[model samples]
Target chain A: MLVSTARLHSVLKTAVDGIIVIDDSGTVLVFNDACVHLFGYERDEVIGKNVSILMSEDDAKSHDAHIKRYLDTGEKRIIGQGREVSGCHKDGSPIPIELSVGEADTSEGHQFIGIIRDLRARKAFEQRVRDLQSNLVVMTRVNALDEMGAAIAHEINQPLTAVMLYLQTAARRMKTLEEQDPQLLSIMTRAVDEADRASKIIQRMRSFVEKQEPQKVGVNLASLIDECVELVMLGHKNDNINVISNFSDHDYNLTVDAIQVQQILVNLIRNACEAIKDCKKQEVYVDVDIAATDVFIKVTDTGPGLCEEVREQLFKAFTGTKRRGLGVGLAISRSIAQNHGGDLFVEPYVKGKGATFVLRLPLGLDGADGQSNLASASMI
Target chain B: MIHVIEDDFSVRDALQHLFTELGASSCTYSDAESFLNFLKQVTAKDCVLVDLHLPGISGVEVIKYLRELSDPPHIVAITGKSLAEINKAFTGIKRPPIVRKPLKEECLLREMDLGTALNSA
Candidate 1:
């Protein structure tokens, strides 16, 4: 019996999943090595504590009643089967776990042995898959809109071409006539001007829809951000806004379309500058942070932060709070970011603080296939 | 002489009228096959405005055939397609000056003059 207990202890200590044994009074009897690691506590710290200490607040409140009910009714709820549950770490953060509980009648009384497997990594992987699937759907819809825009531009441009030519031809003929009417000439000129304006609108629409394949090349992240900041500051030379750049210690090298990425940076920096133009704080913060799979470029301003209503419409085409231009800048910027397997979003607004916009780009070249298809569709 | 090859009737007529007003003698064709069939050879003194999209034979093929002649005409590409499309179609070849539609009068006149000057030279 002594040899058997030592071997059992060794097995519990070496198991990959956490194992814990609790007595009838809910006191932890055995806390294995894996259990110590999973709970962020040492075996000595948890061995004799109430098992309820490892449970979430609500779970702890009902755990004792559950044990008593099961003991009295001889009923089993989770005693024989595995199910997902939340465990409270020593630091008080909830940890997702798959737990299976079993009971054994011993000389000391009934004891429960619980085995737990951490589900954090698997849950994160599942969430990432769901996000990618949704991104693919958005990209498909954007591509269809690009194709329809191209067709519309082509069909309408032909008629506009003919109309402009006819109007200019009429005006030229009038100039050649012996008796030219000044009012007719003026009216013809105005008509020609309107046609020109219409043509320009079409050109703008075409440009918005035009999909040029991203010429991705390796570039230093610091230098790119510096260049973009300089470009933006040049336009605001007279403004008193303070621009601060914070780059992480590690030098990041990213493969991206430099010009497109630069466009997004310039727009973001310029928007931040404009936001704080009238504010007393007059500051813009540009920060670059690196993660394992992606890099984030955050632009924070000192202006009035975005409200709920404006934030909702911030990324939609033709909707913006600014009085000067159509709000397609953010919309186009977001699409460009998405095409490169990245994302652009406004951070949650805080009252009395400036808004923050984050541009996230994947470090790897994984979205090349979707981008190429978009390029072809837009070109057509 | 200026030759206009366009599948669209209204555009072709307007271009013809515009070239006439500019005092340049011009001829028009609706497709590449007709133009190639009619014009056995083109000289350095001539200029051609060819739409990149044509009905029977593609404008790219016509441009290629024209380029092979001993003295090819000065060719200008006109298209409603985006610049990216044009660049892709003309990859690996020396691209000609492109005029996008709806055509700007000044842009057309300038390209026409440049073509005529280059051809005559």
Candidate 2:
């Protein structure tokens, strides 16, 4: 069925996408309503204007050359092909658009009609999908790391624990033997210590993986803090960082998961060490206070304070400020604290001074909900 | 006499030593295959301390195969994994007593002595 020219013209004018027809010289001959709306131009404003005006600055400069080359060679590079290109909006901002051009042999001469689809909404939607996919990948990878760490901890801990036990048993036997060699006993003692150290490392990994239920019990807060400090400060003494511990002699026995609390301390201490890595006079001060209803453990470091970006997402998982940090350390630490019927927070950071992390634990089980039993750990 | 099937060399030697110190004759195998091969000549009244983690056939499989014999040796499961994790392998079968490792001397000695005494009785 052949349609009349008037009817075809009205149909083209009401099309959803922008349509513009240009002559051989690149002069705009026919501009539809969609084209006018898309380019923010009136129909009369662009009828006789150069089509290059609708292109971006760089595209506008090369568009005429491209047409001249096509005319000279009679070759169609983009004439029959659809492509993604940038268009110049009337506001001078570049807009992503998909364009397909078709050439026709008209009675007047050669003419090119371009169908332009605005891709701002589509591109934004595509980008949003990509972001969500990447987030899922990151989350899955983190979860895989947690499972792997837990497996490794169990495997390594077994042998290390065995070695420690065997060494201790051997040392006991040697002591009972008549005329035991002191040198041999000393070597055996060192071996036992090394095994103990390896077991401790595996325990750290297990605690960080947080794959088990928190065994909450009444533990001495001061002793737990000391043990954590000892664990973190091991092999770090040569860095010239003075670790000062001030404990209130008051009885601070609290029902908490000792292992989880130790993990939080290790994370805090490690973070403080990283923070003060570039400082000249480095010091990490741990202060313990026993209140009427709660016990507070403050870890303060002497270094460059928190930046705006780090401060905003300090407690958020996967947002570490360190170069090689997993970023989940603080998040897990804070979670463990909260699970113990308490909270963890960064004391307002002071510039040029340092940062202080406060861990508060409740003295009683009144406010201690079952939320603490939930897993409060992550792996790198 | 007892048989020890453990993959870790240190822990394997330690178990052998502990058994020897307790005045019991024992043999050690690094994997389940060797222990299974040794089982052909093995007799009753002996105990097998098979670690739950092994290179081939697994400790659970070894236990299941032993239980098929007319007079199977008393099998004790040694593991670093939690008891609940290992218990899944013992469904519809006789579950052996599990001894957790970093094996304390008293716990292992008690388990081995109990198994030997039960077998003799």
> Which candidate wins on DockQ?
1
Q: What share of the true interface contacts does candidate 2 keep?
A: 0.31
lDDT of 1 by residue, B1-121 (tens): 8888999999999988876766677889999988997566567778888999886688888889988888887888899977666775787988888899999778887776545643443
Global Cα lDDT for candidate 2? 0.74
| Model 1: per-residue Cα lDDT over A208-290, one tens digit each | 87644676776666767776676677677888977888873324567787767877887899899988888889988899877
For candidate 2, write residues A118-158 as lDDT tens digits: 89999985675455445434644564466456555665656
Error of 1 at A316 (Å): 23
Where is model 1 chain A poorest over a 10-residue stretch in terms of lDDT?
Answer: A371-380
List, for all models, the DockQ compared with the true complex: 0.27, 0.13
- The residue ranges of model 1 lying beyond 4 angstroms of the native Cα positions read A1-14, A130-151, A170-188, A206-380, B7-9, B17-34, B53-64, B81-95, B113-121
- Candidate 2 segments whose C-alpha is farther than 4 A from its true place: A1-18, A22-95, A100-112, A117-133, A136-162, A180-194, A207-380, B38-44, B69-74, B80-95, B100-102, B114-121
lDDT of each: 0.81, 0.74
